[model samples]
Target: MDMDVRRAAELARIELTADEAERFGGQLGKILEYIDKLNSLDVSGVDAMAHANAVYDVTRPDESRPGFGLEKALRNAPRKTADQFIVTKVVE
Candidate 1:
């Protein structure tokens, strides 16, 4: 299939030099040709999958642990409310 490199570049909002456009046009043509070849394949009974390999979460279970008390946690604050940090108002 003939590819219009200039039109494709314009549609993609990419500015390419004349030499670069010619180079990319050939590369894009080859990529499309490969896609066409893949489209010609058949796998009527194959199950759809996101990956060819098995995937699993390798994370540890979430477990709560003891932590610093509220007073200790806020000991270094320059300004404080009864149970919160006091900072300058941000919005006008």
Candidate 2:
């Protein structure tokens, strides 16, 4: 068992204990069998699917509204000038 396990591990370039190789081989065989069952299904007429089939409400009349962000916007700043945020000078 150790020789077979070691040889298989060497062929795959993986380090596996004697127990782990046997364990993984059984698990992998089951997964491959499940995939084969899925491949046997006939989806000959089903269309390739997208996430959802629906249209969104996208059209609305634009309206003019007064904005209200002069005071609260600059309240947390260390420096502000005339209803605008004052940032540090970058150019000399």
Candidate 3:
């Protein structure tokens, strides 16, 4: 487990002191033990699911409505042509 900790730290480019290595090695060992315990469980009768509860889209339905005209939409523009706002060239 200590070796695993050292290898993982090396792969992650992390510098762990001896004390930190020992502490983390013990923690990792406990986590792996718990995983092993979970693997021993009998889950054959259980159904797989993406979520524990049913999920549904709760958004309001889309509805078209009257919109502000071009003049009102561009009322605050600092620069505008006859029919549209003029913006600085962004791509070229």
Off by over 4 Å in 3: 1-3, 41-92
Cα lDDT, all candidates: 0.87, 0.74, 0.87
Of candidates 3 and 1, the better by TM-score = 1
Q: Which candidate, 1 or 2, would have the higher lDDT against the true structure?
A: 1
Residues 1-92 of candidate 1 have per-residue lDDT tens digits of 56899998899899999999989899988888777886677978988899888998798668887798888889998899987889999999
**Candidate numbers, best TM-score first, in rank order:** 1, 3, 2
6: Cα error in model 2, Å: 6.7
Best by TM-score: 1
- Please give the TM-score that candidate 1 achieves against the real structure: 0.42
lDDT of 2 by residue, 11-83 (tens): 9899887789878778776777677786788999988765577656797679867675778767798987887
Error of 1 at 50 (Å): 10
Query: Taking the candidates one at a time, how many backbone clashes does each contain?
Result: 0, 0, 0
Q: State how far residue 27 of model 3 sits from its true place (Å).
A: 1.3
**Which lDDT value does model 1 have at 60?**
68
